[model samples]
Structures are given as structure tokens and as C-alpha cells.
Target: MTEPRASAFITRNVLFALVGGGLGGILFMFFLIEFDHFTSTNQFCTTCHSMTFAETSYQQSVHYNSPSGVRASCGDCHVSEGIIMATYDHAVGIKDLFKQLFGADYNDPVINLLHLPDAAFASRDWFRRRDSATCRRCHLQEAIQGTRVHTAAIHQEETDGKSCVDCHFNLVHRPVPERSTFKREAWNAMVEQEFGLEPGSAEQLLAAGRRPAGERPPAAAAPAHGVGNGQQQAGLEP
Candidate 1:
């Protein structure tokens, strides 16, 4: 009788354990599904504190509203497709959240890139390095048959390792004028530096230090040539 009672008690405990474990697992799965759904939405992304400028630009972009009535949201372009990529993105998002919470001047770089002169090349570089996988997912090459020469040329040029953002950097957003002037100033600085003239005094220095065409300066005179040229092309101040 005692043996039977012990067996009954063990069975009861096992049943309770199974029920509790099953419920916990179900709750966890439900939470994950809800979290994923929430994060996938454009509203969640645009509402984040760091997204003010980006949100404004997105609203003004053709992607927001076009003749075809199609719209692409922030997640459509910024988030990688697939569960693994999404999980990795979320992990990065957590890190960014922590930075926003604790780091001083967390949004300084974003502000500088949007408004300051000679400080936005890093942002441009970031755009340049992105893979066109997401863009291609929506704008498939096979579906892009058109008679427009420029459009066709741009599509064909993708074969040369150029991403869609290369030519269409400002497609969804108007670039800051200061950023454009920064590029020109940076170029002039490179020319000045190559001729051993003062930086930022490009026009005056280049004029006074002008060397004849095909007349290469002494190699020692331009020790920083490579560095200057890289800064010029990248629109970065040296």
C-alpha cells in the first residue's frame, strides 16, 4: 500500500512539472513572436530618439508615396532579411540602446554628419559599404526592363561592384549643402597640399604655387600625396 502511495505521489509531481514547463515554454514563444512583430514595423524604428533626421527624410522621400502607391519603410531598407540576420540586428540594437542610455554625446556624430561641413564623409562611407541585397530584393534586376538610357546604364553598372546607394545616395533625402561644399573644399585642399601650399587657403595658395602642366614636383615635396588624394576623393578634411 505504501509503495503504491509513493508511486502515485511521484506521478503527481511529474505531471505538475510537465504542465508548468509547458506553460513557461509557451509564454516564452509568445513573447518572442510579439517582440519580432513589433520590431519589424517602421513605426518602431522611426520613433527611436536617434532617428529624427532619418524619419523626416523618409517622409519626404519618393518611397513614402509614389505614383504606383508603393511604400518602403525603414526596416525594408535597413534591416537584413532572415531570422538570423534579424536576431543579429536586434542584438546590435540593444547595444545602441545602451549607448544612448549611458554614453555622452551619443547623437553628436549624427548631428555633425547632417549639419556640419567636412564631417559627413564617414556617413557616406557607411552607405557606400552596404550590400545591395536588400535593395535588390525589392528592385530585381530581371524585372527592370526600361528604355531610359541612364536608368539602364545604372542597372548594368551594378556588375562593376557598385551598390544602388552609390549613385542614389540622396534619393530618399536631400543632402546638406554644407556637406557638398565640404567636398569641394576638400578637393581644393588636396590640390593645394599636392603643390605644397596651405590647406583651406586653396584658391589663393593654388594660384600662387601653380606648377606648369606635366611638371611633377620633386617626390620629396609631396610626401603626403597619397593621404591628401584619399581625403580629397573621400571628401574628408585632412
Candidate 2:
């Protein structure tokens, strides 16, 4: 009789433990889901001092100030879709956290400006590597009917294995050339003329990963947008 009672007690406790564990797991998952959602908001993204420049430009762009009232937050463009990719993107973003805490004096606008080129290039490259997947999340190629017929034609047909970033970059952030046409000489000149930065100062700072001075290279002309390859290089300006 005692043996039977002990067996019953063991079984009961095992069942109760399983139920408790399962409930705890669900609550933990719920917490993670809520945290992810909160982090995706524009408010959360621009909280860092480094992101203030981005926020200022984004707020003025068509993404935030559209006539149709359509608004795309920073995450909608930068963060990939689906839980797996989204989580991975957030993981990669931990670099930004580290930089904010221990990296450059990004609190200064001039110093921050020097680093913007690196950030812009890195982001554009990420989009290209991902085949501009985040852009595709909202912009379906087949569904695209641009104001110009040439634009829609470019979307559906005759092109290289080009992604959206190939042509339609500079949509939101400070205008940088599409990667294919990005010349370091042009960039150096633009920054010099635009911000009074000496040519190659950015490259030096980027190379050092901080605000260190170095020799300035000769400047050249800025990049101009070209309309070629059925790629409507100048689409509806945002």
C-alpha cells in the first residue's frame, strides 16, 4: 500500500511540474515578443544621440511626411522581416550599443558627421547582401506601378541581378551615391565642400575607428545620379 502511495505522489508531482514549466515558457516568450515590438518603434530607434541626425532627416523625408499619410519608421526600412531575421538584425545592432557606450564622441555633430559616410555605406551594403529584402517586404516587384511607365518596366524586366539598393538608394538618409557608382574621390570632395571637412579626413577617422587626424587627399567632383540600365535612377523623390 505504501509503495502504491509513493508511486502516485511521484506521478502527480511530475505532471504538476510539466504544467508549471509549460506556463512559464509561454510567459517568457510573451515577454520577449513584447520587448521586440517596443524596440522596433521609431521612438526607440532614435533614442540614442547618434540617431538624432537620422531622425531629423527621416522626419523631413516622404516616409514621415507623405501626402497619402503613409509612414515608414526606421525599422520598416532597416530591419528585416520575420522573427528569425529580425532577431538576427537586432543582435547585429549590438555593435551600435557598444559604440554608443565606449566609442567616439558621437555627441558632437561635426564628429558624428565624419562617421556618417561609413554608416551609410555599411547600410547600403547590408541591403545589397540581403537582396534588399526589407525593401521587398513592402514593395512587391509585380505590384509596383510607378508614376512613370519606365519605372514599372524596370521593376519587372531586363536587368542584371540588381536589387533595389542598386538604383533606388538615398531614399531616406543623407544622399549617398548608389554603391556601383560610389567613387571615394567624389565622396571626399562632397564632404569637403559640404561640411568643410578636409578630403580623406573621414577615411582616416574611419580607419582609426575614432577621431584621429591624418593627411588629407586631393578632392574631386561629387557624384551625379545617372539614368541608365532601365533603372529609373531618379524615381519619385522622397
Candidate 3:
């Protein structure tokens, strides 16, 4: 009788231990996931001084403010939507943290790119490859209304595989310039020289009409009707 009671007591304790441990593990995992989500917020992204320029530009972007009252944050654009892709992004972010700490100077474009060519290229490539799936998350075709004919045409054309960033690369953050070398007027002049017409000008509209059948303007040259056409068209901003 004594031996049976002892054995029963031991079994009960073992069961309690297993159940308690399982609950504790689950609680810990929940907190960890919540913490990760918190860190992905816009506020957390601007915590680093390296993001100062990006944050400044984002504040003025359509993603930050629009008539519809819907807003997208840093994570919406930068982080992947799927669980697997987001996990991979977090892993890559860890490596980027190390690089930012020791290898690159965020304020010095030349030195930063020189020291982190791979990182720079990787970022550009990621933008080129992502196909604007992140943007589509909110701007789905069914949900979007009042799309301009030109904008609709561009969306249809992208079925050939061009990503959104290919055209809208400067929508949020202009390319960081070399130290003390960025000038808006000079940049505008360079653009006008390359594209044969100033953006949003009458000449640009005429040039668009005259542009050869198969030739596409450089991506930096905003299309006459697509994502870069400023605020006139609806359902184009992301």
C-alpha cells in the first residue's frame, strides 16, 4: 500500500511539471513574437540615426499621409509580409546591424558604399526583385478605385515582370548623395539633360507622345502616367 501511494505521488508531480513547463514555454514564445512586432514599428526604425534621412522623407510621403487616412509604416514597405520571408528578413537584419556598427558610415555615402558595396547592391536587388508585393498588400486591384487609364496601362504592362521600385525608387527616399554634394537644381538640370524634357513640363508630354514605340525611358525618369506622376492620379500612390 505504502509503495503504491509513493508511486502515485511521483506520477502526479511528473505530470504537473510537464504541463507547467509547456505553458511556460508557450507564454515565452508569445512574448517574443510580440516583441519582434514592436521592434518592426516605425518608431523603432527611427531610433537609429542612420535612418534620419529616410524617416524625414517618409514623413512627407503619401504613405505617411493621404486623404484616405490609411497609412503605411517602415515595416510595411521594408519587411516581407509572409512569415518565412519576414523571418529571413529578420535574420538578414541581424547581419545588417553588425555591418552598420563596424563597417559603414551612414552619413558618408561614398565611404558607406565603398565599404559596403555588397550591402548596397543587395538592397537595390531586393527592391528590383520584390515585384511590389508589399505595396499590393494594401493597394489591391479590387480595393483600388479611380485608377487613371495611363496608370492602369502601366500596371498591366508590369505583368512582364518589372517591379514597382524599378519606377518608384525615389518615391519615399531620394538617393543619398555624396557628402555636401547634393543640390536640387543641379539634379533637376541633370534629369532634364538626360530625358530631353523637364519633368511635368509641356515638353515632357510632347516627348512622351513622340517617344519611340519600344523604347522605355530610364526608370529614374518618371513615367508620364504611372507611380511617379505626383498626386493628380488616384490609386497610384503606395
Candidate 4:
């Protein structure tokens, strides 16, 4: 009797473990929805104190404070709404989270190309394509029906089955110039140094240095005949 009870207990434990494992796998498969739900919450966005800057800026942005009273949360634009799309989004999020948690210089520069995972970047473009598709699914009739400014800007030929996000991107997500403003200023300073001019002197030089060709410095005339400015024999001069 004791042996039978022990055997049954072991079997029950194994079954429970198997069931739990299966459920975990299912949740993993649909991780995007879970991630979207997490990010949708105000707590998630504001959890990091450093993110206060982004939160404040977003609040004041035209999207949040629009005259039409269309208030959208951070996740509305940044996340996919549909279940499957959200799952896909979650997969991408997992990779991004990995980079953020384990990356060498994570959060140091906040936006460094070198630190980005290739998979995450590619997945981002993929997400944009998906979002464009989502937009068209609902807006196809409207697109065909009317004359919005976008219709003119986006020729049918240009769309060619590509996502609108391919051409249109959020200002926040736009690529930073490969060179920084400081780098541009530094380059200009170097150019001025090369020309033996200071930064402020350029305006003065352009303002006062102008002279007609007639008023320009004359070329030294050929030494009057052969008596080359006293270099020739003194007797050669009349």
C-alpha cells in the first residue's frame, strides 16, 4: 500500500511539472501581448526615473496635446494592438531587453548604433512594415475614396506593397545624423584654422576686403628695359 501511494505521488508530480512547462511555453509564444500590456501601463513608462525626460517631452508633444483631443498613450504608437502583432512585438522586445540588461555600454549614450543588436534593428524595420500593413487594412477604402494630402505625396507607384512606415517615421525614432552638431562645429573650426583665419574674421574679411580688378595690387613691371632696378651695371642706365 505504501509503495503504491509513493508511485502515484511521483506520477502526479511529473504530470504537474509537464503541465506547467507547457503553459510556460504557450506564454512565451505569445509574449508580445504580455509586453505590450506591461508597457501600456503608466507605471512601466515612468518606472525608470531617467525616463522622466522622455515622459515629459512626450506629454508636451503635439500627439498628446492635440487640438482634436486625441490623446494616445506611449504604447499606442510604439506598440501593436492586435494579439498576433503584439506577440511579434514581444519577441522583438525580449531582444531589446536583452541588450539593455547585458549590453556593455547600455544606457551610457542612450542611443548608440554600435550597441544595437542586428536582430533588434532588423526586427524594428519589420515592425514598421507590419504597422504600415495594419494602417492600410483599415484605411484602404479611405485611401481609395478621397483626396488627402498624403494621397498626392504617396503615389500609388511609390507604395508598391511597402509599409507607409518605410517612408514615414516617428520623429523620436528618426535616425540621428551620423555626425553630431558638435562635430560639425569642430570641422568648421578646423577649416578656419587651415585658412589662417579666425571664426569672427570671416564676416569682416568679406565686408572690407572687396576691391575691383582696377584697384587691385599691380604686377611689378619688367625691369625698365635692362637696368633691372640697380641690379644691372650702373653704366647700363642712361
Candidate 5:
């Protein structure tokens, strides 16, 4: 009788353990799915106390409001495609999170503007590292059969070694120079032009040497003798 009772007790405990584990796993998955969905939203991204600058400028960008009525939200560009990669991106973004919470007072337009290039360059580099995977999500290079005379050839040429942001940056933010030509004065000039800043205020900031690398210096340019010249001849870019 005692042996039989012990066996039944052990079996009951095992069943309860299995049920509890199953429920816990389901709840975890549900939380993960909901959290990933919510965090991918533009509203959630811009909810930070310091994201007003990004929110406003993004609203002004073509991705936000386009002629085709196909608007790309913040997540469409910023978030990776798969759940795993997207979570990795969010995890990496903790640096930005800490900055917003404890670093510079980005609420100030001037401060935010000062740091804008840093954010922009980081984003561009992310695209490069991912081989412009996010851009390719919407724009298939082979499918870009367009009216521009040089578009097809340029696309083919760029495919040899270039990523999309290598030549196609500055479309969505205050303009930064092409990576090949990015220098301090040039970046300052563009900032002034787009932001309607005082004619030389940015230059003055440059002169004062505040944040020497507002935009990271371009990589040493590749040889301009072949591919570079071809793009130039076609009136396109590298």
C-alpha cells in the first residue's frame, strides 16, 4: 500500500511540473511577440524624452511622407527583418537608451543637432554592415528599371562593391555629405542650409572645435581610375 501511494504522488508531481512549464513557456512567447511588435512602432521609438528631434526630422523625410503614398515607418528602416535580428538591434540600442537617460541633454535642439551627425553616421554604418539589407527589403536592385538614363548602369556598377548608403545617404535627415567627401566644413554648410541656421554658425562651431567628428570622416576613397570614373561619366555617383 505504501509503495503504491508513493508512486502515485511522484506521478502527480511530474504532471504538475510539466503543465507549469508549458504555461510559462506560452506566456513568455506571448510577451515576446507583443513587446517586439510594440517596440517596432514609430510612436514607441519616438516616445523618449529626447527623441523630438528625430521625430520632427523624420516626419519631414520622404520615408515618412512620399508621393506614392507608401510611407516607410521608423521601424521599417531601423529594425532588422527577423525576430532574432530585431531583438539584437534593440539590445544594441541600449547605448542610445543610456545616452538619452544620462548623457547629453538631447531635448535642447542645439544639443540634439550637434549629436545628429553621430546618430546619422551610426545608422549609415549599420546599413553598411548589414549590406543594406533593410533598404533591399523594399528596393530590389534588379527591379529598379526606371526612366533615368544612367540608373541601370550605375546600379550595376555599384553592385561590385558598394552598399546603398555609400552613395544614397542624406535623403532622410539633415544633409550630410557623401561618405567619400565628408569633411567638417562641408557638413557644417549643409547643416546651415537645411536648418536655416545662421550663415556661419556651424562654421563657427567647427572653428571652435566642438565635437571634431560630427560626422565620421569618410573611409579613404577607393581608386577613382575605373569604377569611380565610370559613375562620373554617367553623371551618377560612386
Candidate 6:
């Protein structure tokens, strides 16, 4: 009787321990996934400070001012409508994860793409196309109404071409409005001058910072005299 009781007790303890350990592991995994998924840092919409321009504009727009109290993150506007699309976005994020880890290709505003890998050049096109989709998704109602000038451009796209954000991103969520311009001709010419892009069908709508390559613009140039170290870049125009 004594021997049988001891065996039973040992078995019960082992089972309980195994169950507890499994549950703990599962909970930890869940916590990690949530932490990675919902963070402001993880979202591509907030990936670049330049991207946040529209975020600021929306906060001040009629959407936020209305009594209904509607507020949205970048995901709400930029993500596609289906699970398939969401999964695709996550798949693409793996590259970004590596970039963040290595501190490669950071954007301007210290948050935007300050450096770009000229090697995988198609990535920029992918980013722009996706952003354009997000614009159409949220502004579809407004586009239907045709209240804004850009909406006219949206209507012209054959299929997926109508993303209002592609051309008209003016919002900055922060009190400071950073002025960034996408100079189509000058930027391409500059990038070609530096990178020596081969002659081919090039996308003209690509975005570029107003700053000159390898040198900061006068407005963004370092201040002659300041309170702190000269390392600090000038804040964007409000």
C-alpha cells in the first residue's frame, strides 16, 4: 500500500508540473506576439517620420473634430481589407525587423528613412504602392463625394492608382509640422547622378526629401550657435 501510494503521488506531481510549464510557455509567447504586433514602433505607417505627416493632418481634420470621436492609427488607414493582405504585410515586416536590428536605412526626422539601400531598389515602389492603397481605403467615401482636388487624381487611376496619400500627405500628429516635399524630377536626377540608375522605365512619382543628398539643406543645416551640441538637426517647419 505504501509503495503504491508513493508512485501515485509522484505521477500526479509530474503531470501537474508539465501542465503548468506548458501553460506558462504559451502565455509568454502570447505576450511577446502582442508586444511586437501593436507597438507604435512595429507599424509601418509610423515606420518613417515622413509617413506620420498625414497622421498629424488627420488629427486636425474634420474626422477628429467631429463629436463622434473617431480616432485611427496608421493601420486603420493603410492596411488592406482581408486577412490575406494583413498576413502579407507581416511577411514584408521581416525585412524591416532586420533593418532595425542592424540600424540600417533609417528614415528622416530620425524616424523616417534617412538612409536607403540602393541595392534592393524595388522596395521603394512596394512601399509607395501599399501607401497608396491605404489612402484609397480611408478616403474612399470622401473620394466618392469629390470634395478635395486630389480626389480627382484618385478617380483617374485605372484600378489601384487612387490613393490620396500618394501625393497629398500634409498631416503631422505632433504639434510640430515637418515640411517634406517629394521633388520628382530633381530627386530622380540626383539619385541617378549618385547611384547611376540604368536607363529603363523609371517610376517618376517616387518620393525624396527636400534636402540635398550627402548635405543638409540651409533651413535644416546646423545652427551657428545653440544651447546644446551642434549634433541636433533643426526641427521641421511647422
Ranking by TM-score: 2, 5, 3, 1, 4, 6
- Root-mean-square deviation of Cα positions for candidate 4 versus the true structure, in angstroms: 21.5
Model 4, stretches more than 4 Å misplaced? 1-36, 49-57, 109-124, 131-158, 173-238
Residue pairs clashing, model 5: none
How many residue pairs clash in each candidate at the backbone level? 0, 0, 0, 1, 0, 12
Candidate 3 clashes between residue pairs 3 or more apart in a chain or in different chains: none
Residues 90-144, candidate 4, lDDT per residue (tens digit)? 5666765665465433222112212222323463566566655544543463345
lDDT of each: 0.55, 0.67, 0.55, 0.46, 0.66, 0.43
RMSD after CA superposition, every candidate? 13.3, 7.0, 13.6, 21.5, 9.5, 11.8
Q: TM-score for each prediction?
A: 0.54, 0.75, 0.57, 0.44, 0.70, 0.38
Model 6 poorest ten-residue lDDT run: 222-231
lDDT per residue as tens, model 2, 1-238: 3346766766977988989999998998787667667778999997886677677777777878989888988888888887667778888899989988888856545456556667878998999899998888777988888898688788889446998887776667666555455565554444455545666665665555554344332222111221122122222122
Candidate 6 lands at a TM-score of: 0.38
Best by TM-score: 2
lDDT of 4: 0.46
Q: Tens digits of per-residue lDDT for model 3 on 1-238?
A: 3446766666977989989999998998786567668767988887875565456657777777777998888888788886567767777788767756764444332222122223334665776677777877887644433557666655665547666555555456544332234443443333344345545442343233233334434332332212222222212233
How well does candidate 5 match the true structure in TM-score terms? 0.70
Candidate 5 local lDDT, 109-188, one digit each (tens)? 44455556677778899999999998999998987877988898788766778898887876765554454554555455
Global local distance difference test of model 5: 0.66
Residues 150-181, model 1: lDDT tens digits: 76655765557766666555456434333444
Q: Point out the higher-scoring one by TM-score: 2 or 6.
A: 2
* TM value for model 2: 0.75
Best-matching candidate per lDDT: 2
Which 10-residue span in candidate 4 carries the lowest summed lDDT?
A: 218-227
